[model samples]
Target: MTGDLILYTNPMSRGRIVRWMLEEAGASYETRVLDYGTTMKAPDYLKINPMGKVPAIVHKGVVVTETAAICAYLADVYAEAGLAPAIGDPLRGAYFRWLFYAAGPYEASFGDRAMGIEVPADKRAMVGYGCFADVMNTVEAAVSQGPYILGETFSAADVYLGSQIGFGLQFGMTEARPAFTAYWQRLAARPAYVRATALDDALMPKTA
Candidate 1:
């Protein structure tokens, strides 16, 4: 709970989501940017994340990989930031609900869609997300009643899920329903989100 926090990320990767969560958590951390296929696959980096993926974090000697896990870890450790509902808090159920929902169904469905991997109706039961329409509709409903995922308290769920929604919108993956558009707009206006985006954008690779 009291050690240096190190983030291994790339500006263009999902690491941006972890960066946003770090800013929201108000944690002091160092960042090491790993370029794809080089530093990312280097032996040293692989030790941190055997999968050799960006957006890993080392905190108090604990290594966390995967964007949602990293965000949740930061939120729990930095409880003072109030980025998660406390254990036993009624909202805690809903917090985990949407957080893992995004990490699992939303992520799976969106990735499949982007890759044009359709799940036939007969195979829908085997796939966790069921179908693209169901997944998107669920996402729409999740944000429709919200200024935040938990209705009011903005938690790390928003940081992870909002980043997914934001990315999906930017890349033309998600439908621009009014609810999603308005919800993303609200999250984009957060001070932490602004800072995180500016920092990452500054690190983007230059174009010729």
Candidate 2:
């Protein structure tokens, strides 16, 4: 994709995650904030994403959807930013591993619990996340050995996974485990994370 990316987002949604990714990549982009039930569904926006989701991006006329995909895309295209592992690096496998796991089992497991959806014991094996406790335990151990997911090298994978943990803890989807808290503190201190949050906060609507 060429030219400045156009990010279609809502201030109070998962779009914040993508905004953080954009900032991390030092991407040149413009934000188009969509209202909850209106502009998001308008024909123009629908053309970009039929699901009417916030956090879609248009780069050189190519549309990118899904938060994880967009984050990875930016990391790759902006290779100089060093947000991703180099292609031939053996670490690339582990890099993609945690990134997808975060969006998959990590998110679905806790999110299922938050919405009061309980899986029967026998059915747990069939589920991707298995159980919330197991999922959290795995994540905690994953970060406990880290300065970053790649162990000393901060990359885009941390951005996605760390954001999930941060949001999950903030809204009760996950517990504030020491490992998770420490990981979030490291990520939250990044200038990009701070800038993205501030930019999004400025876009939020003021309440009376």
Candidate 3:
């Protein structure tokens, strides 16, 4: 494993998710902490992510942004970590299914809700998630059969989607349904999760 992996992130942001992923992959990486408005939007960082976002990774001269994409990319690059199903594995389909589901519908639906924006019932067809309730119900079903998303196997899909589930429950964006709480409990207990979270927590700006 080369030490060429660089993670550009802010402690209080979605970067924590990638931190967890890197820890899970047992990757050797350097963290470059960027403040939200200043360093994050500066030209040097903008070259890394034009949108000026947190949680971007540069590995061996290649840049990857977007939380889900970063997790997926790292999983493939570090195959020995076994964070992904093999390409021809039957479970591969379901892996991509729930991974993108969390990135898309699950995130979109909850983002809209957090901002107090509600799609009209008549316009539900135009909205990808249909409704917040539908998204929540579908997510509940996905995790209900778990010890992990792929039954007994844990993968990058769990790390990415599981982080979203964790954020939702933490911030009151998701209800404390029995299934959601239990699933997060299982994921949170991971040593990787604990290590990643402790690292970021220590970097968080201290309050006066």
Candidate 4:
């Protein structure tokens, strides 16, 4: 594999999720550490991601931003590596459903709880997650049936959603339910997860 995958990221950020995904995809990538207020927001990087996000990626002259989008993009581009479910596969629906659910409602609920913000009684219906309890319950159900999120096959859904689950529990934004603990334990055994953790740890000091 060519080392043409360019990852623009900062240490101690959501970029770690993408790093784990790259390892899982077995994509040879080069990381470009971006200082928060400097290189990350500068012209060149801004051109790549107008929002000035650290976890963007550039490959084969194409740019992808957003952690979920990036993970899904890599899985599709490196399809031969089998990190994603094929387009017509029935499991693809399940993969996308959980992936987007994590990116949207799960994240929203996590943020809401972490900040101690409660949705207004009248506005609850307008909220995508509906209720934080729903988010946790759904996640618990999904992880309970898993060797991975997709069941038996560890897809990109596991990487993105699993990372969020890890962060939420680690930061005390969410509860440490039995299913979450079990799923995380299984995820910890993957070589990709280990390599990703080590690489990010090594780069942390340099970027910090």
Candidate 5:
């Protein structure tokens, strides 16, 4: 808990997701706000992550990249934060499922839709997301059974999925299906989420 935590990020990017995770973990961290243009392509930051992406972390001398990986790592490292299910717990499997699903299918499908890329139904198996409709339907079914992803208890999976749903609704990229609407409400009620979002809001410009 006494080690240095340097989070390289831009306030408006996916880095915000890791910010929520940091708040949920109750960990002390420093933000090195990297702007999207030349700053991200600079040599020093590129060494940390070849992709030149934000949401990368340097904790206790180890560097972690990728938003979902960072979130999962923080939850496991700060076990007392109770952001993850216990190792042998049955819920652990489901926790991993949603986390990976959000990073994989959900993100892939969102990009495909936004870019207007169409995958033929016969070749859908070659695409990671398969189909946009399938991805949406699966997520809707999962959240509909919830107060949380694993039922009853909140976990890091909720942070990842909840953020996706929040973004989806904000951009109208995905429908406000009843289950997603309910899940979004549940996640918005979290004190940590409120605090993190307020902090992010303060750091960035307000949009109408």
Candidate 6:
């Protein structure tokens, strides 16, 4: 908890999402952007994350990988940020609900669709996401109840789900349903989100 917090990332990758979470947490950290195909696959970086993935973090000498896990971990460790609900708070259950859902079902189904892979109906149960349409519909319903995932309050869950929703819109992977549109607008209004996005944009290639 006391050591230097180091983030190994590349702006073009999922590391950008963790960057948003870091900004939202208001925690001090340093970023080391690893170039893809070179630095990222280098031995030193791979030592931090065997999979050679971006968005890995080192805090107090401990390493954490995966975007969702990093988001949840940072929110809890920096409790004063209020990115997460307290342990006994009723919203805590709902908090975990959307967070894991985004990481699990949402991403799984989206990946399947993006890759043109089809899951047979009978085998759907074995796959957490079931199907792309089901995942999108579930998200549409959830955002419809919004302003945010927790209704009246915005938390780290928004950082995860909102970013995914935004990505979906940007790539035309999902339809811009009314609820998703409004929720994304609200998320974009946050100062932290704006600042984080600006930083990422600055790092993006001119052609990108």
Output the number of the lDDT-best candidate.
Answer: 3
Off by over 4 Å in 1: 1-3
TM-score per model over all chains: 0.97, 0.96, 0.98, 0.94, 0.95, 0.95
Most TM-score-accurate candidate: 3
For candidate 6, what is the TM-score? Answer: 0.95
Candidate 5 clash pair list: none
lDDT of each: 0.92, 0.89, 0.94, 0.88, 0.90, 0.89
Candidate 4 lDDT, 125-185, residue by residue in tens = 9999988888889889998885898889989999999998888778777689988878887
Clashes of 2: 0
Give per-candidate clash totals.
0, 0, 0, 0, 0, 0
Better of 4 and 5 by TM-score: 5
Q: Which stretches in model 6 have alpha-carbon errors above 4 Å?
A: 1-3, 206-208
Which 10 residues in a row give candidate 1 its minimum summed lDDT?
1-10
What is candidate 5's lDDT per residue for 1-79, written digit by digit as tens?
Answer: 5449988887789888888899999999988888887889899999999998787999988999988899899999889
Residue 92 of candidate 1: its Cα lDDT? 97
Candidate 2 at residue 109, lDDT? 86
Off by over 4 Å in 5: 1-3, 206-208
Q: Which of 1 and 5 is ahead in lDDT? A: 1
- lDDT over C-alpha atoms for residue 109 of model 3: 93
